[model samples]
Target: MKKSDLALGIFLLSAIIFMIIPMPAALLDILLALNISIALIILLNALFSQEALNMSSFPSILLFTTLFRISLNISSTKLILTTGAPGNVVTTFGNFVGGGDLIVGIIVYIVLIIIQFIVINKGSERVAEVTARFTLDAMPGKQMAIDADLNTGAITDVQARERREKIQEESSFFGAMDGATKYVKGDATAGLVITFINFIGGIAIGMFRQGLGFNEALDRYTILTIGDGLVSQIPSLMISLATGILVTKVSKEADMGDILVKQLFSIPKVLYMVGAAMIFLGITTPLNVVVFSAYGLLFIISGRVIANRIEIAGIEEEVNTDESSADEIRRPENVTSLLQVDPIELEFGYGIIPLADTNQGGDLLDRVVMIRRQVALELGCVVPMIRLRDNIQLKPNQYVIKIKGTPVSEGEILFDHYMAMNPGYVEEEITGIPTFEPSFHLPAIWITESQRERAESLGYTVVDPPSIIATHLTEVIRNNLGELLTRQDVQNLINNVQESNSTLISELIPKLLGIGEVQKVLQNLLKEGISIRDLITILETLADFASTTRDTDVLTEYVRQSLKRAISNKYFPDSETTSVVTLDPKIEQEIMGSVKQTEQGTYLTLDPEKTQDIIHSVGEEVSKLENLGKNPIIITSPIVRMYFKKLTSDYYKDLIVISYNEIESDVELQSVGMVTA
Candidate 1:
């Protein structure tokens, strides 16, 4: 479309003509030399052109050209050598090539020409795709931020992909090709340069044979080489030099060895043999062998040994460098200052946050914190003060001071009521009656004595700050609050909190928000504490959820929610009693037959039909919970019973439902139990 592209087209057509035409032998050689010359020029301009080089296309173009030419020359040379042509001519050029015979040459030429044309046609698009991929992979810590948004509901995959495409399109073209061409062109061109020089020398010999003396030679011609080795190599040498220089300059920050290695293989295998050609010629001439030997040594040093060293050094340097501020910003900071205490140490319980706006679950903490914050907002508390100070003391005995009620203070009642809701609380674990752990462990922070009294009167106690509170709080907040806060919610809650455009947290909001402490604990247990056998059980649970279910994501949520509740209470009663697992009649018979009874209960290996049927029912139960979305819905024995009863009831006559409850716990009905669906 542009002038440069048009020129390249013309050069390609000229090359096709040179390969295809049946011109006089001398004229054909001259045309081949000219064609090579023009190709070098076009390729150089393509490399340095203001018009961007689509690198993805460039390789195929180079490959097609190099292969096509070598095949053509070799085939044509063989034909000419085998024919009754002069032995001198056969020796000079090696053999016939291209269409070794007219018919073969035409077939080869047409096929090569078509392939070359197709490469050119598709080159631009290929470059675009490659550039796009490179931009994504090579971009720095920024990608993590991008991923955060992707995990959250902030950005869609299509949007992220589109942004990446746009960035690739805008980046500099030659900038991308720097390291690639260095080694490939290096070997190819070195051999080419030597050949061109030899051709020049050969042409001089030709002129001398025609009876021109030294003075006459100077007068007759300015550049005498027509078909010398030097002439042949000219194109390759220029291309190689261009590649090396561009690579060195543009990719200065890139590893030198990596660039060189890329170039080394890019040089054709035929080119190596061409370098060796000098040694063959040197058997007859003085300098031929010496020149080839030096060339080979140079290629070995620059293209292999030194290149590797440079790359290794560059990698080491990168390894030693400190992570940039951008990286730091992407990672969450453990801001465990006094005011922002760990929720875990606060004796606060975990709850799932719902993102009604998005399919992903939100952090329950953000909602709770938001409601608490509303108290602040409504009271015109422009700023809530939080401070961390060192080494403050409180009377340990005074922690259990009496509440100010007629019988029990309002503060004590609230504390008791809150503790009552916590299924994890065990009365035997407590030392004193009505003692509530002080949720906050603040030091002397210039608070009025009256403020302290008010806090204590509310049944709060002061104690030494817990060491693990920071990490614990961050985990709780991150798991509980991270998902529920939309950009709008964030903007409203905190005044001018800095935001990142490419945070992965913002991107995959739903998935991140959906994570719970139970899941985190399960992962840790599997990673560090669980036995291989128990690990297999966990994996089996995941696999069942994955293969039999429509969405593993939902099933995982359900399992996590159930696990969270169970672990918090230090009990798995729900899992023990009201399991969603339905034992087949055949499985029940097998278990009964085996009857390996323990003090607590019986255990038996399940059969194939039983396993399959259980797996099927589990999937159906999970599928029926499509209404729950990403959040796991808790199912109790009562709930399961009610569901079955409703299914058969006349109240839901129009709807189809199934009853399945062959499993029940041995524990009393009041004992909380878990059942992962």
Candidate 2:
């Protein structure tokens, strides 16, 4: 076991032993001194701690200390009743501090008991209860604030986790403190009862058992009992004060001492007023004028020093600002500086700056971060950081999304309005400015915020401007993920996969296929809206097939066949049947015949007219399926699936093309339409 753990175990066992076994006066004095030292240590810790969580172990420590003190009280009571002496510590306190008078010692001990029980302990208990309630009640809001910061990239994952853990610790510390205060309250009550019992029982034992006179018994027993009470109560008072300070502490980065010094003397005006009042009192009152005047002079001098410091600080701040401004003006800008471009950039007009500015209460950066996370989960690749800035050249409501310095999508939004799009079945019409939904190019109207409920009631989906832009950005990135996956990105994926499947990575990478080749396969999958999250499975499949072929297209087809279950679940969910369009047997055979193999790779050797006729036929079937409210998934034989997807991807990017072998055996296919040529 650790030395600290062994020491704690031995110490707790000693506390238990002290109650049953009586120790000599010297040992008792040593333990009593240790108790006072421990209480002082706890109090100092509480005073210096900036946050309650910094002393989270205090509740358990409080319980142990209270038990230790109670055991000491029991042992000392026994020693006093039997021998008319508790210990040197108690005897010294009774004689010196209590003035060697029975009446004075009893009065002083009673006052200590009353102060500890009624004042410090009571106040600490109430504060602990209230602080616990507030901490628990505010937990959810604090957690949500952490999440918001995380989503906005204001904090990273590690920082967010730390903040969440701190919040939990604060709540638990207060809750434990709420219960621990009861131990203090009970200890104070026990001390009061123990003192009374010690006095009466000691007097009876001294007179009846030891044959002492009444006056002698009273003097000896009372002095020892009062001394023991003072010894215990003083430490109890210190502990109670510490508990109050801990629960009442406000969480900040600076300790209580620093906070007090900074805030209590922050303003010189209050110090000056107090100093003047003290001087006036010295002049008018019968109090010692010299003492009051001396304090007043000290206060006046301190205030003057503080005021001078504040003035100097202001001057320094202004000088620093001037130097910074001069440095900025003297710095030269070069044309090469403008050559750096963001991988993804969103430019907003000046009027829409509030949508991205955090100081203006805009959550657009947070929304963009969430969009990146969502895209990463859906596409199995991290979206590049989006740089948001204002462009003065654009129209006031306009925005543009750029990829690698080139604008790919543009849209306009009314900052104060909501975009309501008809779900294609709404019977009621809403009046507003007609516009196309930037994400999907669907007909939508920009309506006022007040019209949102009515528009929703009429079967329209309403979204705010930031959400509209975020959605547009998501779609643009999803469509262009192929261009973003460099060989380095593939290496990152391999390194990630290596953590769990080292054997597969070592065997597959740089052996059968290089990173460039793997990048092509990943791009091919991403280009078709397929997720590459299952990298281990993809690499394993490649390990088996890559040795036979260097062709990326052929390899991609093989990988697709291996991911049948994932692909099937994406479109069909939990269903056992899939609705799809199929080609006629003649058309399938004719297309298969046009596929020619060469040294470079495979190619389709079909005539232009034949291909056009086939495209038209397939387009008609797809349209028919769409009109029936079904996704247009085309099922072709395994050999022609890749070629067919390549042929139609430019025109029908949203169409899903799967092969016969790609369908899981448990799924039944129901033909909804057919393409014939």
Candidate 3:
């Protein structure tokens, strides 16, 4: 064990032995001195600590010290009753206080016990109880404040976590103090009882065994008992005061002395008024004018000094501001800095600042964090950090979501209103400003807070302003997920997966396929809104077929077929039948004949008129499916699925194109409509 740990163990063991073992007068004197020193040290430490959490171990220390003092009381009582002498420390205190009168000494000791037990100990216990209760009650609000700061970017994750831990420790410390105060009260009561026992027992033993008279025995034993009580109560009183100071302390970054000086003298006018009142009292009463006048003069001088310091600080701040302004004007700008761009940026108008500002109850930053986590779960890749900025040139309530420096989606919101969306069939009409929801372009209205219950009762989905923006941003990022998965992001994924499945990563990366090639395949899957979360399966599939052909599109199709069960569960979860629109047999054959292979990749070589007719036919089929309230999914032969998806993407971007091979055989496929040319 380390030297410090060994020493602490020895010290605690010695305290326990002090009660059982009898010590000489010299050793007893030294132990008494040590006890006083420890009490003083504890009090000083409490006074100097910056915050209550800094002294988190104080409760344990208080318990040990209380036990040690009680043990010393027992050892001294043994010596006083048996030998009529405790130690030099006790003798000196008794002679100093009694002055040949044991009655005075006993009364003084009783008063000290009363103060320690009734005043400091009891008051401290009450304060600690209330502080602990309030601390526990306020814990939830404090935790929420930390989360708000974290979401607003005012503090990082590590800082917020540390603050939360500190709050917890503080609450626990106060609770411990509440229980530790009982030890102090008990110790004081024990000291009083022990002193009475020593006085009565010592008198009887001295008179009967030592053959002393009654007066002589009473004088000798009473003085020794009072001395022991005084010696013990002094240290006990200091410890009780320390406990009170610690529990009553407020949480701040400044020590008690600094806080007192700063707050007590914060206003100099109060001091000046008090000084004026003192001078008037001295003149009216028959008191010594010089004494009161001297104090008045001192207060006046101190107030002036404080006032001058405040004025100087104000002047210095103003001077610094002016200097900073001049420095900014003289600084040169770099034009190249303007070329830098964020991966994703949200620009909002000035009036919408409250949506991102924590001070105004804005949770936009928190929403953005949740969106990032949600996207990572659904898409299997982390999105880039979103940069939020305010643009004065835009409309007050408008916000724009940008990807790669280009504005992709922009919408407006009313801060004080909620967007109530009609799910296409609502019986009741709630009056409000008519608008379309930005996320899905659904019919919605900006309704007041009072109308929220009515809108919901009418079967309309009600959303707040922050949720609207967060939902819109989520869709925009999901659509651009392919572009967001950079080469570095792919490498990161491989490294993370290698930690658990190292052999799989080693066989696939830089051997069967390069990171860039893997990135392309992942992008292809993402473009079709497929989650690459099952990356081990994707990488294993690539390792199997990548040696034969380097075509990313063809490799992606193979991965999809391998994930057929996952795909089936996503689209037709808990359903036995998958409804889809199919191309006519003749149309599928005609498109398959037009497919041409080249060195770069495969290409569709259909005539412009034929492609136009195919698109018109697909559109008609999609409309018919929508009218039936069915999701539009196109199923075709495995050979022409990619080509057909490309053709319909421009006009029907929301349509899901699947191949017959991608569906599991257990899932029944029902043809809702057919596209004919």
Candidate 4:
């Protein structure tokens, strides 16, 4: 049988024995039995409330003991005193003159007190121990409850109470003590103290006699050495037992306070407050009172000492089963395969330190669990069981993209390593056109007039720079000066040439200018930070003497000659180089060439094959460009009628379209309507 069952049986048997005891002995035994029975009732209630105990006989046992003890204590004590049994027995047992009989009586009383103290203390410790075990078992559920409550911020006292109620409903009687286990383990000494106090109270209640005033009864009770002070303690002892039971059930544990209180409440009943009143009115037991009160006093001191030490119980090292599964899975003989550090900028400083001689892994498992939960919440998916040494697979659908092999700064090699690990991810790079190619290798012709003055005012200057002249042959070649060049194709050519040559600008600058235009050109070239020495070559070429320099309407034929000669001589020192060069010659050419002719009266010419294709292509392009502009137009060279084969239909088109000031009037080119073709 369990300890509690044994205790219950013992108490019940004692109650029965006291009920049937020879009358003189029955009185004191019965009172002691009642207190014992009450303690047993509390123990049985704690275990049975959850229906864990087959205590169908408990009610019968309890009622029987209560009746038997009450009837016997009153009847037996009456019979004993009336027959002078105690006095006769004491005298016969020892020599009172030398104090032998008194000493023997005292020893018997002391033994009784020791027995009572042990019973209460043992019961109290048992309750605490059982309750603590139940508490440890419920830890996971309790942890979940607290976490859920904290997360929702709705953890009010009412919610806590409700939680307790729910636990109580779901749990066995002992389970109610789960919450109290921690407190109880730390209060074992207090449980002892309470037990001692209750025993002392029992003795206090047992020592009283009946029929006297309060002080008079007390004096008589004081003379009763065996049960002195016991009668007065009955009520307190009962209260303590009841309180300890409720507390143990609800808290799932007991401490020294419980033992002390139980002792207080379970004292011999005749010295209870009612008994005290009875003592004043002439009814209590002197011998019972003396023994109970003396024991109560002894218990108080011992109970305090026990309370102080109970909290110090050694926690044995048991493998926490919850942690065992994780421990068993730790990758032994493993090396760190991947490490992901957040805010890679902190890799050099605030990153995780090496764990040797450190606390880094103290809560590593919890951290991993928390992170896994967070990741699940974020991704709206369940993650696989993560093993400490298992590699994180980078499947296409896996959201975590990469991991690092080593710590690194932001934008540093480790970051690059991280970026490289993901096969399909794109890295950032630069794509805009570089400036050197367009200026030096393309037929970057600038209009001298449109109205050339208007073109100049918008910061569009006719390029006459030395670098322009020197690169002229190369530009013509790049622009398809001798080959078919689509605009896009021309752009690609220039880009290719620039990419191929590191100093393309230096090679092209000195070839394109003449001395006659040098001063005006030099100013422009110098504005871009070019040297006068390079300009001197172009000036010297113009000195070969080709033209009059002062003409206003156009450059003297000689100036064009000097400039062209200089450009050709520099880019193509071998005559075969000049023969190989070409300028813009594609569909856009035919269109611009046609526009140059018919839009104005300028002298222009086109091959028959080119002219017709030009007209067709220009017509197609004009239709598209029309939609692109607010009041769209086909703009062409200003001085040549053949320059403009077409014009837009709107008057405001002139205001919006780009032009040159060399045109005498806006009428230099005019539009009829949408082209019929």
RMSD of each: 23.8, 12.6, 11.7, 29.3
Candidate number achieving the greatest TM-score relative to the actual structure = 3
Q: How do the residues 217-258 of candidate 2 rate in per-residue lDDT, one tens digit apiece? A: 999988988889899989999999999999888857899988
Order by TM-score, highest first:
3, 2, 1, 4
User: Candidate 1: TM-score?
Assistant: 0.26
Off by over 4 Å in 2: 1-334, 574-577, 589-602
Residue 199 C-alpha lDDT in model 3: 84
Best by lDDT: 2
TM-score of each: 0.26, 0.53, 0.54, 0.23
lDDT by candidate, in order shown: 0.37, 0.89, 0.88, 0.36
Expressed as tens digits, the lDDT of each residue in 199-287 for candidate 4 is: 34323444543344555433322233233213212322343343245434442345445655666644434224443443333424554
**Residue 136 alpha-carbon offset, candidate 4, angstroms:** 19
Q: Is candidate 2 or candidate 4 better by TM-score?
A: 2
Please identify model 1 stretches exceeding 4 Å from their true place.
1-13, 20-53, 63-151, 160-227, 241-677
lDDT of 4 at 500: 51
Residue 436 in model 4: lDDT: 24
lDDT of 3 by residue, 454-555 (tens): 999999899999999999999999999999889999999999889999998888878889999999999988988899999999998998998898899889
